[model samples]
Target: MVFILDTVMCIVTTMPQTKVPLSKRERTARRLTLCLMTEEKQRRPRPSVPYGPTAKTVAEGVQKMRKRRQLTIYELSALLKKAGRPITPSAIAKIERGERRVDVDDLMALTTALGVSPAALLLPLKDSPHQSIEITGAGEVPADVAWEWASNERSLPLSSGDASEAELGYQLHSLPPGRRYLRSRPVGRAVEALRRDVDRVVEISQRSQSRHPSEFADRLAAARLSLGRLEAELARMEAEREEFDRSSREELERLRQEAARLVEEQSRGGGDDGAGVD
Candidate 1:
């Protein structure tokens, strides 16, 4: 059952110019949240395949590569030509459109031209299940929208790494465990991933608290409260799924009983006619 969110998924359009300075992990989380929130809230149609988060993430990646390289489409075309691949500006546009998939060599060319590491181009533009899509946004980017985009951004990534896994712990800070007033689904992959990250963070917090019990007590309490919030959301989603499953089962049972009754009535009528024949 594919349900369309009539509401537009417009969360993070223009990145914030200035906000709190974030650690590397926090920045990833903030970006993820901002991106995913947009996806969730902004469901507007786009002229691209892999529409929705996948398309948006790819477009964003292309844009990022171009920006990092400090090159316009024309410049990128020139660079590629000089490099011997001879990619056209039209082709660059097509790649950005998510119509054409670029190879690692293409990625390297863009990265080198942009003067950034290949890793920079490959930073999980899409928030994946493996990495936390922690994003932060202000300036009227609705919280619901931000959550959706950040949470689903991971589903958009076309590409991964040990480094990606290592950053997972820090990346989780910006994500919402559940949407406002709605419990995340029991099998909700996003919710489950959040839980896994929480568990890891909680372990770290516990060790820290143990080593400096008095100093970290306040922080530990705060973490516990957050866990409570997430658990509540998860519990609610679980209940909804259970209720839906029960209703489905009941409907099946009713149909079965109706069929059985019809069969019995036919058998009885057949017996009555047989008696007359005998």
Candidate 2:
């Protein structure tokens, strides 16, 4: 009885531990769960505005103008798409939320879509010194006109008269220290492209007049409207170009005068030195 008991104990102690192999499905599920847990631990929330406060201000401005214009995100997106620079509703939402930074092209597109100046979206409107005021003497100012000089003032001041208040404000915002505006080259290029479109429309109008007089009557009206817009844009570009040229010329003249003065001084000093040596 003792030997049998010892043999049974030995058998129990020597017995191998049972092991179960995991099936393919179990292994996959285990891996997926581990991956999910790791991902959850690693994930972090993104900031609302990656570019900081300036970007947030711009975002707010975009939202403000959009709302003021009573435009839906989808409608704004569609307008931008029609302008050949397509943006999605989701992307506009991100911009308004300050989650995304706006690029130059998008900024221009937004300005076009929103029917507001780029300055409207860029500058802080609350701090502007200039405000719209109605003039008493205007015979009949259109509802669309935003600014009119007071009737008591005979003429607009030279400094402010050349450009609209919006343009002046944009120029001021972009001056010297920081230069927070689009380049003149891009503006010029856009104007040139638009001018080409205007030319094409003119050609169509001429052709229509000969081919179909009835069509010409309709097309002529549309052509005039297009011409008016094109001419306005062209005038703006010309004004900017003229200002640039004028400044450059003035600077050059100043430098030339400075060089002449230096030359005169040097000559005078050399003559004095020669007399002393003599």
Candidate 3:
């Protein structure tokens, strides 16, 4: 009986144990663990924001301006070349494709080439869907005026004439703020008319020498008076324009100084107490 028992024990010990299947709860727990690991991976933080204007904004602005002007990339490159800052068509293509960032100098050149303001490139498009309140000449308004207008346009509305001028022409250093540029066509017409009048007077004055001394004197006096009046008008317009420009510049300077002071104050507030430094 002892031998038989030992034989049975040996057989049981030597036999391989049957493999057990995992329980439903165990399998579910393993699946949940894998899902939690995946969720943790998904919760990791993204990279830092890009500096300067976003690539997409710049690219869209460039392409939009180019198309609006009906220009090829090569043509735009040529225009920049003429402006003393040469850029290749491939470079323009890279910019339009959002593969490159534009430098300040390049941006100025691009605006000049495209005949648009720097704001046209730097500012978000105002005419986008569901956000189409007209910015009109908002891009060209002085920085302080822009801030005011943005905050409350009804309280400080932009003059329509000033806005129209801003949209049509750029400001000139030599002229008043809003009335800086006189349309060339009108000026040219005036000049041509003046030339014709001068020529006619010269012809009549020469003929008067042989005809009537009194008539000649009268004609000459009238011409001199007219010329003097024209000169006086021009001088008065010039003085007024200069005065206007001077005031505008002073205002702009004041705004700039105020902005600088505000920025300094903000910086100081955000920085360390500077107790350790000189």
Candidate 4:
């Protein structure tokens, strides 16, 4: 979006709007101008997203800190500036809306600016299969302790290919009372197998389609149309899922607040002591 805006601004600068109407001859002379404007409109870019646990992103860290610290957009923008970004509050707003994909560098800047560990903000949800990590306990454990645990012989079995994740869990549990870490390897193997399977399937499908076009010829264009509809449906379902999650969270928070209010009222009333004789 920024790039598109900049490009549009540049075009505007070069050809400012005119209150004067163009002559038929003049309009005909500048048909290329119309083509350029059409192209510009067609190429508008989507806004950018900040990587990590954003308020609207599917995670907790950034949202939790943003609420706990009670920071406003202006304040966040100031922090971003200090981190050398110098973007406006609106820019941050766009990022929060998940319009663009923020790369690794922006994530580092965001962590430094927000006074958080890069890991905390950037870490995916614990249950998200994208991340192959397990974290537990308190403040960032120092590198020396982690290194010591890594060097210890108790960090046994040396390879991640072992059959059981339960065994991995047990091994970690046995790691003599300090922080333990291991990256899972099975998921990588699974992903590679899936990729190979997909490639073979796609190759086979294409060959089959090419060899037997007559069978599906009536449905070929219709199949493309159906696929597009499915893609649109998937997008709609993704949006609905997000909306449902938001509604559920809002209801949960409202219930918590109501329960807290009731607790306060009960505490103030003091069961039977503060009430009239009953």
Q: How many backbone clashes does candidate 2 have?
A: 0
lDDT of candidate 3 over 4-32, digit per residue (tens): 46544544444223365667666555555
- List TM-scores for all candidates, in order: 0.30, 0.36, 0.31, 0.31
Model 3 worst lDDT window (10 residues): 147-156
Model 3 regions more than 4 Å off: 1-55, 127-278
lDDT of 2 by residue, 23-74 (tens): 7666555555555454456565654434654466579889999999999999
Query: What does candidate 4 score in Cα RMSD to the true structure?
Result: 27.9
Q: What are the runs in model 2 whose C-alpha is more than 4 Å off?
A: 1-33, 41-43, 46-49, 128-278
Query: On residues 136-189, what C-alpha lDDT tens digit does candidate 1 reach at each position?
Result: 222223332333344433322212446555334323543465532123333344
Of 1 and 4, the candidate ranking higher by lDDT? 1
Error of 4 at 200 (Å): 43
Return whichever of 2 and 4 wins on TM-score.
2
Model-by-model lDDT, in order? Answer: 0.58, 0.63, 0.63, 0.54
TM-score of 3: 0.31
Write one digit per residue (lDDT tens) for candidate 4, span 124-168: 333211223322322233332322233342232323465476446
Q: Which ten residues in a row have the lowest lDDT in candidate 2?
A: 146-155
CA RMSD (A), model 3 = 27.3
